[model samples]
Target: MPRLLLVDDEPSQLKALQRTLRGLCPDLHMDLALGGEEALTHLRARAHDAILADLRMPGMDGLTLLGQAARWQPLAVPMLLTGVADFATAQRALNETGIFRYLTKPWEPELLRAHVCAALAEFQHRVTQQTQAAAWQAEQGVLSPQELERLRLEREEPGLTHVEWADDGAVLMPALDAHLPSMPR
Candidate 1:
């Protein structure tokens, strides 16, 4: 079962959402917070698979809270809900904060449930990938200094093609001689 946190300043709105989500997602363990501060408190106590927050609030807004949540719990998927449909705010939330979804107010219960389920699935996928990568790293011991340097260079220069090490530890790369810019030959 996935854990979720929902934050809103309005008590009535929070209660309504809570009741609806609980009915829709009976398997999900949901927690409600009155404001951003209380949300942060709940976040610090335990990790949640997803967080849904209202964009407008008194002290700490949803965007700010999401940012904090990202730093505190990178695995958790963050989402924003706002009454107004502001493109600029939505863009910022998607680009800067990496919000999973931006939902407008008066949301349909089914749509909200679908978005929450998708976010939970995504979070689970990420966690599984991280675990697999860690296991692979453990099986394959640390890379050589030369290989590490090559990897660093490859990351720095996106134009470079992929490179792999052979069984004998030889570096192999695609033939880029013909693709190179013409020289004054």
Candidate 2:
């Protein structure tokens, strides 16, 4: 299940956010924090797919919290929900924190829900892309002789070290040649 963390100094605001989300997404798992410290504690305990924080908290503003959240959960989508509509703060949040969305106070429930859904989708996409890239890298890279031998042994039987190498640091697998028809010597 996708998880979300919502941080706000006001308990009522947190409740409203949770209510809006629950109405939109019944299956979403949400964790609420009253402050940045509480939010960090929740982050350390479990992984969340998205984080939405208030911009002006008593201590540890949303930008700072989101920046730290990024360090802890690099893949988590960070979002800012602030009453202040300062352009400089928005720009800083985008550039420094890499927030997926910046929403102002008195947010529309439907739009907020849509943004959360989009954030969750973005998180899933990032994870899928990372997995695919890693898999492609593994397939394209040359495996060392020891790794090849291990794979061969695991596939067939133990004590089967069929990996061969030339003196010039090139891999020469004898098994591959054995599969080919005999050529004129």
Candidate 3:
């Protein structure tokens, strides 16, 4: 199940939204926060897949919360599901907060569901990529000098010949491709 954090000041709005989206994302685990401060508290409580936040709120607005969230959990997909979507507000949110999505007020249920799914997919992809990168780094730690040199050579010359002088060419392959003859003058 995808864990979600929703931040808003209005209790009624929060409840309605939760109800509506709950039906939308049956597999989603949703949590509520009354304001940005509460949202941060919830964030610190546990790791969540995504965050949906309002732009306007009392004490530590969504943008501030997003900035802090990024610092704490860089992989978490934080989105601005706000009513306010003016040019300046959008610009500020995109530039300053690193928002993944900006969903305007009175958004469609289907659209909301779509966005949530996309965000969750992106979240999963990021986690997978991070895991793979970490594994590669760990494996690299066990490599011998010869293996490291082979990797460097493969990177530097995609189709390097194993033959004669190139200063110190790491022999990536035992023999160069026989298909391509040496260049004609």
Q: Which structure among the candidates has the greatest lDDT?
A: 2
Q: Write the per-residue lDDT of candidate 3 for residues 35-107, one digit (tens) a residue.
A: 8877766665566788888888988888889888776566679899677678888888889977889888887
> What's the true lDDT of residue 29 in model 2?
94
Write the residue-wise lDDT of candidate 1 on 21-140 in tens digits: 875555888989988888877776667889999999999999999998886677789999999988999999998889999999999988998998899999889777765655565568
Evaluate model 3: give its lDDT.
0.75
lDDT of each: 0.81, 0.82, 0.75
- What lDDT is reached at residue 34 by model 2? 88
Model 3 TM-score, all chains together = 0.73
Best by TM-score: 2
Instruction: List ranges where model 2 is wrong by over 4 Å.
Output: 142-185
State every prediction's TM-score relative to the real structure: 0.74, 0.75, 0.73
Model 1: lDDT of residue 56? 96
Task: Give the range of the ten consecutive residues with the poorest summed lDDT in model 3.
Answer: 154-163
Where does model 3 exceed 4 Å of error?
142-185
lDDT of 1: 0.81
> Clashing residue pairs in candidate 3, if any?
none
